[model samples]
Target chain A: MAFGEFDLIETYFTHRLPQRDDVTVGIGDDGAVASVPEKSDLVVVTDTMVQGVHFDQDTPARAIGHKIVAVNLSDLAAMGAEPAWISLALTLPEINDEWLTGFAHGLREICEYYNCQLIGGDTTQGPLSITVTAHGFVPNGKAIRRSGAKPGDWLYVSGTLGDAGLALAARQHRQKLNPDYERRLTERLYFPSARVALGQSLRGIASSAIDVSDGLLADVGHILKASHVGARISVDELPLSLAVTESLSAEQAITYALTSGDDYELLFTVPEAQRGLFDTVTAHSPSKPVCIGRITNEPELVQLRFGDEAWELPEGLAGFEHFRKTELSQ
Target chain B: MAFGEFDLIETYFTHRLPQRDDVTVGIGDDGAVASVPEKSDLVVVTDTMVQGVHFDQDTPARAIGHKIVAVNLSDLAAMGAEPAWISLALTLPEINDEWLTGFAHGLREICEYYNCQLIGGDTTQGPLSITVTAHGFVPNGKAIRRSGAKPGDWLYVSGTLGDAGLALAARQHRQKLNPDYERRLTERLYFPSARVALGQSLRGIASSAIDVSDGLLADVGHILKASHVGARISVDELPLSLAVTESLSAEQAITYALTSGDDYELLFTVPEAQRGLFDTVTAHSPSKPVCIGRITNEPELVQLRFGDEAWELPEGLAGFEHFRKTELSQ
Candidate 1:
């Protein structure tokens, strides 16, 4: 049976998502009321996932819910903000009980794990799209930004990249893979983790930071543009796992690491002075940050170097352009 | 020429919109940060407008932009929040420079008037849709909610309603019009003024409150549902202009007042003790708040009375359900 908008919200959203004490008002109100703790600033981020653009109809509802919310949380993590409350604006083609249940279940699981509260949201009838506006808190003057990197800053990236890209390339293709590697790559695609803890820990330590939503090269280029500095990245120094190495050639893997989007990994810059603290910081953490390159005094140039061979690349660039390219044919 | 998302953002959105000091971090970041003044709580609301569902393709880009932002501000006004910052997620069929320029201009005008900063947002390619998440600040514990009305509380509404409905109905026909009446009705449809000032003034005084978005009958029903109270409204007591009276029969006007959506006026309740305060509060306001009904102890019944006749009405009812019958026919 077709459901009205209000009824749909009541059934799919209201009580299904995790709630928190900080949310004084929840669903069914004109707007949600949330209380940010004293001495903390609120970080608000909104991202919209559209059908055919962000995801296809055949994608599982649970995975769509997880990825949408995960991508939003990644923004907060990039700013060194702790996830607090989120409001969802979901527009659906039609109400499907099973789909709603799976979507809410997936959303709830992540909120529970992340300690983020689902405060309030709106549900309407339209093309299937999910717009999540998440709120996070950061200590005063502690939130990281992309404009803080200096010439001598060391660039670091957390975890292996390009696996998610590779998984996407092979999602429809029947490619043989080792069970462990296949699972790892698929998890990277469907259940990508936001580096919240790692980002929060780097609050006062990292000079500049960004989340890898667009490919590493493009996203890091944002830092270079904002920071007004050049960067030299060594393709050989790029991080890759055995799964990634086994799945793709070294050159292909490097390309994915540099240009594949949706990694959700934290890329940051640390001053040379704090370079020694890297081992100390990683010893206490579950994952270590890998140093990939160094910032340069030269302006508007990003070069790649491999021992005796050096190549001049795109100027001050990295990442995918949403409207520029149709596909990665190269 | 192909444009990178970053370049498109810098070229079009970065400094094109208004800015306010309340925004700590504006666009070009992982998230936007706005400061909530001491002793105040943040009020947030979101609204999504889809192309085919909310507005027609021929609808002016400027009007669409204004309506999208206005509707969200209306929600904040219902809660007595001062509009502060708005983050937009705009999904478009393509980058039409003329449309973007017009839309941004319209949005900028409202932002300037409301003193709201255009913070971080996303621009992506998709079927045309704009999702706006607006934030405001309210004094702690002063936000008027729908759950505060008591049995003896008197129901009131600011300004006349139903003009928007009439305008929508007559938009395509464009039959000969009374110029004055046409101006007023079209204003109701195209440029609704959210009762922000009045709602704020009633924060401490109003027992319950809501914005007339879906229609008076339906929106007030939300308050009834939340407060667990019933109401008795007099059809003859509904405020109406001479234009509306001349344009339609008394019964039709009453029905429009009750069920016509898009008025964006405030409907609120005040206790008997505050009856004397109404004149004083509304004396300087542009629109007078007129008392039309009273709350009852009954559980789930809303009744309408006209002279000696009394008719039972739907409980917790409002106007124009997304999947329900369209108001245009009635």
Candidate 2:
């Protein structure tokens, strides 16, 4: 069949996805209407992934669909909100049935897992790109903000970092890797999970929280800037997956952990007063989050220590930059 | 200066726009947090415009920005919701200072006029395309839907149609237009306004509503399909602008009015009992709405009349289709 825009949407997008009773209208109307829970504040997040800039032909269509949803939901996770609804604005160079089926499958998998509904969106013909705007709900006055961190708060990070970066490094021919490590690391790069439940659990316990999207240090810089506080990170304590650590030297693995983006883990802080409660609360969580640093009173100063000695950042370390010609990874 | 994504956003998008008290968290965060007033349902709409597909090089960057926002807001207007906040996902081929300035100015102008704030968005490097996801609110259970039109309802439209389509036809050299008509019709194409107050006034009055983005007939088909009813439109009564009438033959003008898209006017249906009340409610609205037809009991059949005689649709008349090779107007 010659696929029209509405036909493509109706065949691939409008059915078999998760549904919500709160959504009054979905897909067909000009706009979607949904009821927000009373006494809850809405958290809105939008993210875009453009072909060539964010992914390549080698990347799976399913992974592209999965990552776009994961990235936006990660933002809501940082705010301690429960994912509720999503609006997708999809632009495709052309309609390919195989790609559409795979993409929708991946998108539906994540939405079903997160229990969020696809409320409404627009599909247009253009370069292959996707923009997803996710809406979530947090109890009024209870959202975790990056500005809430204070001095003496213990910095923590969920899950191992650098695996995605390591995968990218291998793909770019910057490094050689074992077949086993490469397989696992590639999965890391393709299917990074947002720390949703962990983030929600830390809402009251963590002084501040942010998702580790733009590398550990750069994302940490955001919290420090917003909170007007400094941080002291123990370099040796940086989380590294076995796939990352075994594939490169220890120093290189640490560098990747510190400077790589696309790791959708939570970087957060908890005050000394809440340390006991935090530990108790996260005991049964998805991942055993590790303490890697502490907030300091000195504003905007990020101190790094390897064991008891001061450590310096690797020269020319860079993360993702969309407009800049030089980017660390694709 | 090296323009990075953060710098592009900070310099052009982060300041000098309308601010909202409901926005607890705005740009610079992972997501934006806002409070929806109690007893209101949230309306979400998203739209995307691609450079080559939606507009050509002759189109102004300012107009592109304005039209993206206006189109999304028109969706909210069709649903009888008041626009509240918008998130933009902008992908640009390259950074040009003048284009960015003009685009930002246009975006801010419409946002300021609508009293909606730019909350959160993503800026990426790629082919030029813009996606806007707009949020609005309406009283609980009061959102006008497309599935409520009854057989006896009076069909109404908010303003004159075909001006935008006339400009598009002129641009394609399908018809010759006077210079004055060209300028005015081009303005209609680029600067279409959402009938916000008129739609709000239609809350309990209009049984069904839709915006004329996919041509009047195509959009009316949507309402009919959703409502399981039909409509009878008087071809002679379709409100047409002097520019459209003067530029094209009467048949061509009627074709443009019925089959061309991009005119962001509200097409709604009011019950017979509510006709007087709808007139009273819309008396002070921005535009004088016109009743051009009436709803019919015959399911999914739209009848057209020119005075006392039944009218046939023009041969091979096509509306806007994103994926289809044939398009009426661009």
Candidate 3:
């Protein structure tokens, strides 16, 4: 079978969708119609995953689907929003039923888990890539924007940071790990969960928030620039998974923890006044938010401390700039 | 100068946007936040354009950008929704500053003309493709859906059709056109306007509506299936421009009109009772909607008539199924 656009969509996408009353009209229409509560703000975010750039062409179709949705959901998570809907634009080199089945399976898992509906989308023939635009809602006047962080705020990160980076290094043959460690690390890289609950819990508590897709220093630095404040992050306090620690040297692990991308964790700030009560409000989340540093008055300055030594990023490393062709991996 | 994602976006996409009160937060954040009108429903649509599939790689970046936004706006028009915001996901093989400038110029022109804001997006390295998700608003319970066409509804189509299809045929050298005719037809191809006002004007007047992206027959066929009714289109009543008529034989022009994709016109149905006041209600529109056909009781049957000789579409002509690698153009 040729598996045309409509056929593929009907077979995989139109299967029993968990109905939502808010979705007034869905798939077959020119556009999808939905409703948001009267006083809530609609939050929209888009992310694209390209073959060979964001992921290797040989990666499993399921992981590719999961990572694309996960990364976009992370953006929603950063805004302290509750993800409600998504639109996917999938471009493929050719039609493969098996590939699509795996892709749909992974995609549905995330969509159902987040209670987000795939409202509408486009599927086309081209180099394989996925661009997912996620829509969510945040209570009016309560979205945790990156610009709201203030000086003297306590900086924290949810979940672990370097497991994804270690996985990437292993895939590149920059390091080696046992199978069990490798499996765990690669799973972290491929299926990293979005801190949706953590983000929702932090609302009205965290001063500002952002997802850690592009390493700790880089992602945290975005907060510095947006809020016109600086940060002194304690590298020794940066959290790492056991798999990452067991697989690489302390120096290498630190590098991965500080500079690795695609972790999809939330990095946010809370004022000193809210520190004592942060745990009480955030206890609903499975991932513990770890305090790593403090926001400083020095604007745009990010000072890294590793115990007694003031740390510096290796020369030429500046996070994951998607357009910097050569340094995309770093 | 190499245009990284942030730099290219900051330079082009982040230009001075016209202020929209509904948009609480503009671009540059992890997620863009906006508010929809209270008591109104939100409408969302997404479309993707890929190189060599949707347009030639040599096509100007500006036209590609314009067509992407235009096509998405047409989707919103089909739903009788008010365009509000858009999120773009752009993938390119490499950074070309000239291309980015031209692309942004075209994108901004449409967004400004429509009063839509470019809120958030992602840029990545890959085969060239543009996916735009448009957000709009419709009054509660007032969105004109495809399923609303009734057996007694009189059919109407906005603007002319086939110019874009004729242009596509001209590009492939399947038909030759004079330079003046070619210029006009190609411009029609590249810059077909979405019938936003016409659709909005038809709010309480038209029974059902849809945008003609996949030719008149194929697109209207969708309405037939949705409304569970039939249609008899008068081929003689189908509108065509001088450029299209001059570029092809009468028979060929009819084929192109019925099968050509990318024409962003609206095909709608209006019941007989509303016919008396339809003109008065739609007076605000500059492009007068034309009476084209009538709905029938025989569901899923679309009978096309050229004068009196009932026309049958040639075997195996399914319009613009992006999959079916060989059938994309047909």
Candidate 4:
């Protein structure tokens, strides 16, 4: 039996995802209602994933659902916002009951874990794509931004970088690695955990912050441009996982750390005065935050240090420009 | 010169759109904020338009922008919500400055008229598509719904319906009309206005309501299914413009009026006590509302009257279905 739009919404979308008290109104209505506590502002972000561009057509429905939400949630985490509600716009070639079931299950699992509600969305027919708009709330003026880093502020990055990029390389069979290493890398690429709690805890604490979606060097360049400051990063301090280190040479790992993207880890800066507090916070974290660099007085210049030797990074740093052509050509 | 993401956003999207005081945060953040007045529930609706599926490549960018936002706003009007804020996800083939400027201008025009804020959004590269998520607010439980009609309620429709269908027929060269009539039909096809004010006024007045995006017969069928009732509609009472009547034969015009989509007018049911209020409200509207039908005790059946003759409408009503076979072959 073919289901109409209304029937599809009621059966699969309404009340299927997790519910939260903060959501005043949910699916089945014109829109949804979410509360922003007094003295706080809501943080919202939207991201769309197209079939061929973002993922392969054969990619599982569950992974597609999980990845789209994770990416938008990562933006909220970067802003130190507590996620509350999400709306999804799903465009598909056709409605397949099995695919919808798997997708909803994946979405529901994540919503439950994050305490967010799947409030409302529109489903249409088209080339397969999913757009998720997520909402989070933070105390007024407390949300972190890419600006505010001053000279001498220490730069820190939580967890490792480039694992996701490495995974992508392995998935496309562009590079070969040990079976275990490839599996680990692919897992990171498919299901990255957004650091929401860590970001919230760092509220009123970090001087500047951004999520590492692009490469470490390129994303940090954004902070430099926004804050009107430069940085000197220590090459040795980059946190590479044992799996990554064992799978690739030191030079290759260094290149990946600087240029590979899709890590979803938080990169932040802290003042010298709060060094002790930073230490305390890092000590309790599952992965310790590494001080990889220090902000400089100079503008529009980033330098790298390898022990006593120093090298100037190139100007016009290239990152993942969503629509622009990259060096990795077909 | 090729522009970076930030430069593109600042140059094209930032100040080019409408401004409103309800916007607590506009652009340039993880998310944007808009205030919802106390005792109101926020309504959100999202819709996506893909290049080949929704529009042709030759269609102007301005029309694409207008249609994306307009379709979503129509959903808000159906629920009697006040338009307040919107976020856009634009996936383009490439970043063309001229196209972006035209599109933004069209979007800005609608936002300014509706008192809505153009908040944050995401931009990416893919096959050209645009997704807009609109938000509005209404007093708690005051918004009209699809499932609220009673057996004795009077059914009414606003404005003319068949012009858009006539426009489509002209586009396909199946029918030809005078230039003046063609212009009117095309305008109705491309820029149909959402009856937000009419819907808001019908908040408590309309027991059940829906916007006629689908043809009259199909959309009314939705109301019947939702409200668990039937409807008796008069074919002659459907408001058709002289342009439509002159462009097509009487039988063809009646079919177009019954099955034409893209008329973003309200189709609603009101109790007998509120019948007098329609006259007061219609006096203020540019297009008058006309009573055309009555809700019936029978379930899942819709009948139409033409003078002394009555006929049962077919089981498959005309409307856009995402998964249905295309009518292009016909």
Candidate 5:
């Protein structure tokens, strides 16, 4: 290792961006000092990625860093908020210059891409883990939420799903994937794009929004539970990549789409009356949202459909529980 | 081990406090939505504690929880900021309800004590670790900075020091501590209070301030480096608890006071011209400040005094290096 904590931060992490008027002080202090815009509500979210649990020990440092920030940003996107600042807490078993550089590079890429500033953080020695807490700004009382979905709302999902789950299976050798499919799937798994622009466009149009981290079925379930409504989702309408559709059978693709995790796509609901507004807003968005279902008055009841036929999901395939085991999870 | 992530949070973490108007939204969302006071800058800080590295795995979950929040709050205190909100990222080996409840109790105590709300966070399964990011508000351009120390400033420290490090040493069997001393020291280690009130009071009075987490010598050294000045600290004036002074020799007490980590007390410097104001302000404080030294023009040169004799610290005793191993570190 070529650096201690202070030196490591100085060399690889400090002053990546030019000084900004909103930042009073950054780095090298008890805490960072920054200003929030007047009258804007701040959106705060955090996520932790642990070695052996969230990522393999041998995963490239760049991918590890990119995915951690991406996941947190995905949460902000689900709230219809724009990124502002982030704090990172990193625990590592050792200091490696190569790894640090790669991780910093990946983090910088996302920060630049979103124009978010790195404000404060902590670093310590332990089993490898990364915790990032992100802050964003949204117009007061205008942020999208899961509790706002009404019975007549239409459920929508941004971008594709199932590729990340399939990618993990292929890497674990549980599924045989063609070389091209494997490469594309792996990249999609590591660098899932957070749909910030689409989320912003849906601020007033979408009734409720949430990121699909724990598979479409489970995350959509959160919106239902929070909104006190039911959902009827067509499994055939689940967005899937070319690789997922080509590599897996119809049943396999549906299973991955429903039960697999780490997709990081936005799952939102649009009120029936505002469907036209939602369509017009998303039409200009970089990533278009695909409508998959409609909310119902029957609470806690989720109906799944494949074509015109109703499908029954097997028990225990309802996405991951942090404290419980879920088979074939990302 | 009976609960999933969502269940554990709902039972042990949510609704710990009454609804506040400032909190537009709280737990059970994509991200928390909070309103920051107008024209105030946010103080952001994060700290991570890992089991067996920062604390013993056998340590009580209550103390573990309190100390993690305490450490991060101390950082805010050092910046002369008022606590606003915090986000916790927790990674654990299992979901033992007993542990969760104890941890929650401890955390809630500090959150209530500081009037800071838990906004949002993530919980995952992994080696035990906790990361807390705190946000606070400081009036525009009024926050204290380490770089503000000037020559001829009187340096002062709030509360006592060295008990925590001595306690750690005793626990390691390096010293056979008296039972009472051991208990007091251990309590200080686990639940050290942040000098928030004192820090806030010193906002305009003190030239520079820093929290003594990594021992007075090292932390003061940071203020000196940042301010481009040196210090002459009287070692004889180092504060100690009754138990520490009686149980340890002068040299041992001084060693611990200079090198101990986790004190969480504030060390600040007031300009010579403001000495009267400093004394007047602190005399009314619940915890009075003790003047220990003076800032000098000699850059990077720290002089330690013990009455008529100048003292040199023993080598390799300069506080903590998180990435590097120190023999007596937690």
Candidate 6:
């Protein structure tokens, strides 16, 4: 029997998912209703992934579904909020049972891991695209903001950078790697983890936070723009995975780390007063936080250094622009 | 002077929108943070409009923008929630300044009227589609659900129905309408009002409620299925606008009202004990509520009546199925 839109939803999304206690009303309602705990603020974020634009056919359906949820949760993570509920607006060109099953599996896996619930959504027939709106919660006046970084704050990033980009490069045949490294890099690309726990731990310790989705330099620029402060990054201190460092030359690896997007790591800052608490908290983290830079008194000027020498980004390395025909853009 | 995604957002969407007092963090952040009232539940509804599926080129950009927000708000209305904030995930085929301007204008117009704020959103390069996730608030335990109706409840509908469907038929040239009626019908189709005020007024009185987007019969079926009860619709009492009544034969108008979608009127039920109170409350409402039917003890059976005579739906009239090749499917 051919599945209509309603049947597809019933078969895949409407059942067998994580159910949260806060969700007063879940699926099969005009709208989902949820209770926000008293003295807690609601954090909302939305992201869209288009078929050919965000992911090619080479990207697995499960990975596409996983990446969409991960990206939005990464935003919530950046805000130091506890992931709560999500709503999906899924548009499909056609109904393929295998693809839907795989996609639902991936979506449910991430939601389960984060203890988030799929509260409600709309599934319609259209181009293959998924838009996820994720909601999280943080205690009142405690939600992290990009503008909270002070000039004297020490900047840190959770997890390694550039592996996702390097994976993309290998997939596009712009780079080559050993089979083991290729598998590891591809895994990083397909299953990027949002630093939810680390972000929550940084709530009181970190001065500001942002997820590294638009490359390290561009995302840091966002912080500087919002906070009205500048930073000096020690390029030598940038954390790179063994896969990226082994597969590319030093300059190429650094460039990838600085300019590549889709690394869902938290780039954050800790003030001098909170550095001790930050270190103590991160010591228990699975991914060690690396302090690579410091916020500066200089306004809107980002200085880069290698050891004692001032450095510049390699020529022709640019940030991702979605509307432009950029080679590395997603 | 080409527009990048960031530039496009900054130019058209970032500024000049309504600001809500509860919005602690708005656009220009990884996520938006808002304070939900301590005693209220958060209501969320998402809807997507895809090009060539939900709308065509002839549909104005302004109407498209207005309708997307309106549809989601209608869902929130059905739940007896007050519209609050919205996040948009807009995928555009290309960046057209004029289209963006008109779309933003319509969006802002409705948002301003409803006192809803445009929170953070994501804009990407892809096919022309708009997915809006709207958030609202309702007092705890007061949200009207579709499953709350009891047997013998009086079913009521807000405003006239079938005008939007007639407008669509006229636009498709399947039927012709007088110029004056055509203008009125198309206006109904493009700029349908979600009964926000009236829905809020039904908070304690409505036993069950749903928005009539998928025609009368289909939506009534939704309420019946959820409530686990049957319904008997008095076809003679189905509300029809003058534009719909005058342009089509009686049977055709009824068919349009039963099978046509996108009217966005409220279909709700009030228990027998609440009739006197319901009438007293609705007396001050802007739109006169009309009694159309009653709930029955029979399960899952929807009986139609035309003044004392049993009636059946005409042949070839099917409900809108998004994935099916139905003639009137959206």
Which candidate tops DockQ? 3
lDDT, candidate 4, residue B42?
68
Q: How many clashes (backbone N, Cα, C below 3 Å) per candidate?
A: 5, 0, 0, 3, 0, 0
> Can you give the lDDT of residue B201 in candidate 6?
90
Deviation (Å) of A193 in candidate 6: 0.3
Candidate 6 lDDT tens digits, B191-305? 9999999899999999999999877887887888899999999988998888888888888888888778899999999998998999998897877789999999887788889
What C-alpha lDDT does candidate 6 achieve relative to the native structure?
A: 0.87
lDDT of each residue in A1-330, candidate 3, tens digit only: 112556567778878555678999988888999999878999999999988888886788899888888998899999999999989888888878789898998898888888889898988888888999999999998888998888899999989988887888789888787577888888998898998888888889999999998778778877888899999899889888888787777777788888778888999999989987897887766789888999999998888899878986655554333334444322
Q: List the candidates' TM-scores in order.
A: 0.92, 0.95, 0.95, 0.90, 0.95, 0.96
List pairs with backbone clashes in candidate 1. Answer: A217-A318, A218-A318, A218-A319, B218-B317, B218-B318
- Model no. 5, DockQ: 0.56
Better of 4 and 5 by DockQ: 5
Model 5: runs farther than 4 Å from truth? Answer: A1-3, A314-330, B1-3, B314-330
Q: How many Å off is the CA of B296 in candidate 6?
A: 0.8
Question: Which residue pairs in candidate 2 have backbone atoms (N, alpha carbon, C) closer than 3 angstroms, thus clashing?
Answer: none
| Candidate 2 residue B184 C-alpha distance from true site, Å | 1.3
In model 5, pairs of residues that clash are none
Off by over 4 Å in 2: A1-5, A318-330, B1-3, B318-330
What docking tier does model 6 reach?
medium
lDDT of 3 by residue, B93-137 (tens): 877778988898888888889999998899887788899999999
Q: Which structure is stronger by TM-score: 3 or 6?
A: 6
Taking the tens digit of each residue's C-alpha lDDT, what string does model 1 give over B252-303?
A: 7787788878888999999999877866887888878788899998854688
Minimal lDDT window, size 10, model 2 chain B: B321-330
Cand. 1: chain B TM-score: 0.90
Candidate 6 Cα RMSD (Å)? 2.9
